[model samples]
Structures are given as structure tokens and as C-alpha cells.
Target: MVKIYYYKEDDSPMTAPHDSGEPVAAEELEKLGVFYKYIDSQASVDNLATERQYKNRDYITLDGATFPGGEEALNAKLDVFFNEHIHEDEEIRYIIDGTGYFDVRDNNDRWVRTLVEKYDLLILPAGIYHRFTLTDDKFVKALRLFKDEPKWVALNRIDGNTESNEFRKEYFASLSS
Candidate 1:
């Protein structure tokens, strides 16, 4: 029952823009199969506490759960460590609380800034260079699901320096300004 929305090779999902809001409903989530889930932001904190019960709950490699690491991991203050450039095999995210923006460079070289808030699910395919920054509010908590067993790849760390690569330069330049 997974719903896969494929963009044309010329139109990348990255760089697409969207408004922030509540998580997608359970029925919609079920259709995504193991793709993603946008945890409801309006849910009481007590209800949100049971997020872990859904861990490893699906057969797909991209199983996701909101607030996976708990409130401490999510509520921590935002820092540069949180500002990162990543390109993954497949990136899936579910917003559990707060709001943020994801800047992505699509295959067509178009830049899209997508505003995400509670309950918004975002999925990005491989080879897209992207980064995230805190919203003006500076508070965000979400579940990140990766198709790869070990989900994140720091391009700066892998490539050694952001300046050495053209893609890195473009990525940083786009996000910074």
C-alpha cells in the first residue's frame, strides 16, 4: 500500500517548496508503507510519548517513527552541528514538533525551499545535495528515516572540505544566502 510519488528526472523533489503544518493522517501514512509519517503536532505531549511503540514496525527499509530518539534529542538547542549538508541513499523525515526549512538542489539545478512543520513528511531520493536550517522559532523535533542501514552521510566530512567541490560550493552558497 506504499504510495511513491516520483518526480520527472527534470523535476527534482529537492528544491520543491511546501508549507508547514500537521502530520499526514494515519491512513495516508499507511499508504506510504515504510516511507514516512508526520507525527501530529497537536497531540498532547503524553500521547506523543508512545512514539517508540512503532519502531521497526514495518517491513520496508525506510521505517520511521516520530520522536525516535526521545525529547532530549529533539528538544536540544539548535547548533551548527545541526546545520549539515547531506546526500543520502534515500532520505525520509517526519516532523514531530516545531518548524524548519529544508533547502534542496534538484536535478534540474533549481533550488527549492520547503517549509515544514508538525506532521509534514519529506522524502528525498539519492544524489541530491541538501541541508536544513532552523526556522525563526529555532525549535524543531522530528523523525529521520533512511533507506540505508546507517542513515546520514556528511558530505563535508566525506569530501574533506566544502570549498573543494563545486557541488559543495553551490550547496553552501544556496543555503547561506
Candidate 2:
């Protein structure tokens, strides 16, 4: 099941949740411009592809399918992914297997963590500060999507790049409209 909650501010493991978990509703997520969908796990890959094509995610790359260097390599990738950052374009992912948490900064600047599992499709609007980390299972297979050629650039918040970013401005403007 998909779970959305306010992330606890602490030094706990990324996958650990707070006692309350402060659940968030789907409508709240929509207001933040986060799109989420759940398809039956039994659905064929072709069906998922077709649905994605309809949404303009034409480029797809699978990660965690064949980890040559094993879990350590996957951990390295996740370490990079866990950094809070914004992308010039939207970040899209279709969870092919396993579970993970995506922490997105809301309008109030609070962290909203969402749990995504098999068959979950999540799209973070361009310029939204977000990060991802796998659950204790330490395994996840995801199909990253892009509209054109894949560009996996993360403008990290630590770089102070978000304030002047065009996409970031547009995203905030969209919330007001």
C-alpha cells in the first residue's frame, strides 16, 4: 500500500518512521503537484509502457535489475539519490519491485515522505526538492522515465541553485495559480 506522512526531523535511519507518522492525504499531495498512481502488480510491462507513453515518458531506464557489483553498488547509487535536490525536469519513476521512500519538501518546507512499492508510479514536479532511499529490504527495481533523452542531473540544495532556477520558480508559481 502507498503511504504518505510527514517525515520526522531526526538522525534516525532514512527508512525509519516517527511514532505518529503524521499521515498525509492524497488531496494534499495533489496540491503539492505530486502525481501518484498504482497499477496492479500483475499488469504486464507492455501495459505499463503504454500508459507511460501516454504520459509522455518516452525514455526509460531500468535500475537494480542486474547489479554487477552487487548491493554495495546499489548502496552507492542510493547514497547519491538521498541528497536533497531539484531537477530541471520532472523526476518520474515506476517501481518494478521492492519498496522505498521518497521525501519531498512541501510548500511549508516540511518533509513529506511517501512510501512506494511494487507497481507504484510517482512523478515529482520539476524543481521540487526531493530525495529517495530504499527500505530495509535494501532492494528495489525501478524504471526511471524521461520525455526525451534521459538526463539525470540533480541540482543539489546544498549548492544553493534552487532559488534562481527557472524550473523552480515555475513550480512555485504553479502552486499559486
Candidate 3:
């Protein structure tokens, strides 16, 4: 099941209703500008490649998989992304196993913490200030999506980023026009 939590950008939990109840359809998430999909969890470890194989001719894709190194390793990577950073390209993942949270910003700049589990495919728009973390179990295996070979660099918000300067937000927003 997928869960989405609304929070403060600083990572503080929201006082109001954060968990928006049970997982809903990806189309529902689309309304909130999130791209999500549910697939076969028991599929092959390298499934995302096969999955992307059938994309329309005009749809170009380049991606790879990630196996979360349990708690310690996840925490190490967390120190990078969790600094509340933004990527130049969309951050996407297809969960092969385990669970984790992708904390993104709502239009109002508050955080929306989305919980992704096995079979869940999550796409966080580029330039969106967000963070990532695993659940208590400290386990996760996922297929990462990319437009091309990724730079693997996240421009942290702490380094002089402002709410109004999200280029990827406008980039995708324009596509919807």
C-alpha cells in the first residue's frame, strides 16, 4: 500500500491530517502532480528495463536499479538527499522490495511525504525540494528511472534555494499546458 503524508518543509510533522488515508489510484496522485504506478512485485529483479521496453517510440527512457543497503547505508545516503535538496531531473523509483518515503513539496511549499512499497513506482518531478528515507525495517530495493545518465547530484535547498526557483516544476507544468 502507498501512503502520502503532508508536512512542513523542515521535516517537522504536520499538525493537521498528514496521512491521507489508504492508497488511492495513480490517477488520483496525478491530480497532485505525482506520477505513480503499481506493478508486479514478484517480477524479475531487472524488471523495470523490461517494463520500459514497451514505451511509445517518442518516449525515451534510461534507468537502473538500486538495492538499499539496509539502515546504515540508507542513512548514509539520507545525509545527502535529506538535506532537503532538488534534482535537475525527476527522481523516479520502482520498488522491488521494502518501503521508504519520498518527501516532496506541495504547491504551498509544505512537504508531502509519500510512502512507497513493493511494486510501487514513484516519480517526483525535477527541481522539487524533497528528501528520502526508509521505514523502521530499513530495507528497500528499487529501479531508478532517468531521462539519461543521471548526474547523481541533488542541489540542496540549504545552499541558497528559494521556493520560487524550481525550474523542473515549471518545466513539467508547461508540458501539461
Candidate 4:
């Protein structure tokens, strides 16, 4: 069950926000310019992982257990990689196991914390401001999708004002309405 919650950047309630796992569908996410799908079962997740093919893209998996320091090392990697940034390539990921939240800004520039769990496949388009964090589970195995050998690069814009954020610019048409 993938759920999304909107919050102001300044609204620091000082608590975790993975509240309700309300049923959210792929079509609903598309309205916010995101593509999402939930696998039928663990069998499907395994098949997808083994086949390593999606639509037309290739996917590669990253496992926390295989890292040098295991969970700690993997958390460090995720922390470094996750940030308020936009990418030139679509950032697609499948949660093979564990859970995390991907906070993506909406048309109003408010953070939408999306809880993605096992068997969840998410496709975030290029040039979207987003970040991620693991839950208390603190461990995740994910398969990353790529059009080519992935050259991961992100333009971090965490310090920008509302007017200057690219999210505000592109979504103005919808926001203005």
C-alpha cells in the first residue's frame, strides 16, 4: 500500500509522518506527474528482479546485506544519495524489500511523503525535486531502473525560495488554476 501525505517545508512537527496507508493507485500518482505500480505478490517481485527488464529499460539491484558494513553502510549511501534535488534522468526504483519514504514536491511546492514498501515500483520523471529516507526498519533492497549505464547526477536546490524553485515554475500552470 503506497500512501502520500502533503506537508509544508516549515511544518516541523518533530515526528515521523508515515501515518496512514490509504489505498493509492497508479492513476492517482500520475496526476502528480509520477508513475507507480504495486506488484501482485513476492513471486512477481522475484521474477521482475531476475528478469531485470521493465517496459524497455534495464534494472540493477542494490542490496544492503552485501555492503561492507551492512545496514550502516547502506544507510550512509542512501543518506548521501537522497536530497532535495532534480535529475536529468528519470529516477526509477523498486522496493524489493523493506520500506522508505520518497518526499516529492507537488504543484504547490509542498512536500509529499510517499511511503513505498516491498513490491512497489515507482517511476519519478526527470527534473523533479525529491528525497528519500528509510523507516525504522532501516534496511531496504531496491532495484534501480536505467535506460543506460546509470550516470546518477542531481542538481541540489534545497536552499531555494518558493518563487525560485523549479518545481514552482513548471507546475505554475496547474497551481495558478
Off by over 4 Å in 1: 1-84, 157-177
Model 3 TM-score, all chains together: 0.67
lDDT of 4 by residue, 33-101 (tens): 787779857576556645645333444434566767886687676776566777766678887777777
In terms of TM-score, the best-performing candidate is 2
**lDDT tens per residue, model 1, 73-135:** 443423333344555344566666666665554434433455667777666544345556555
What TM-score does candidate 2 reach? Answer: 0.84
| Residue-level lDDT tens digits of model 3 in 93-113 | 777777777777655666667
Indicate the worst ten consecutive residues by lDDT in candidate 1. Answer: 55-64
Ranking by lDDT: 2, 4, 3, 1
Order the candidate numbers by TM-score, best to worst: 2, 4, 3, 1
How many residue pairs clash per model?
Answer: 3, 0, 0, 0
Candidate 3 at 69: error in angstroms? 9.8
Model 4 TM-score is 0.67
Off by over 4 Å in 4: 8-15, 18-28, 41-75, 159-177
Which candidate leads in lDDT? 2
What's the lDDT for all of these models?
A: 0.45, 0.80, 0.61, 0.66
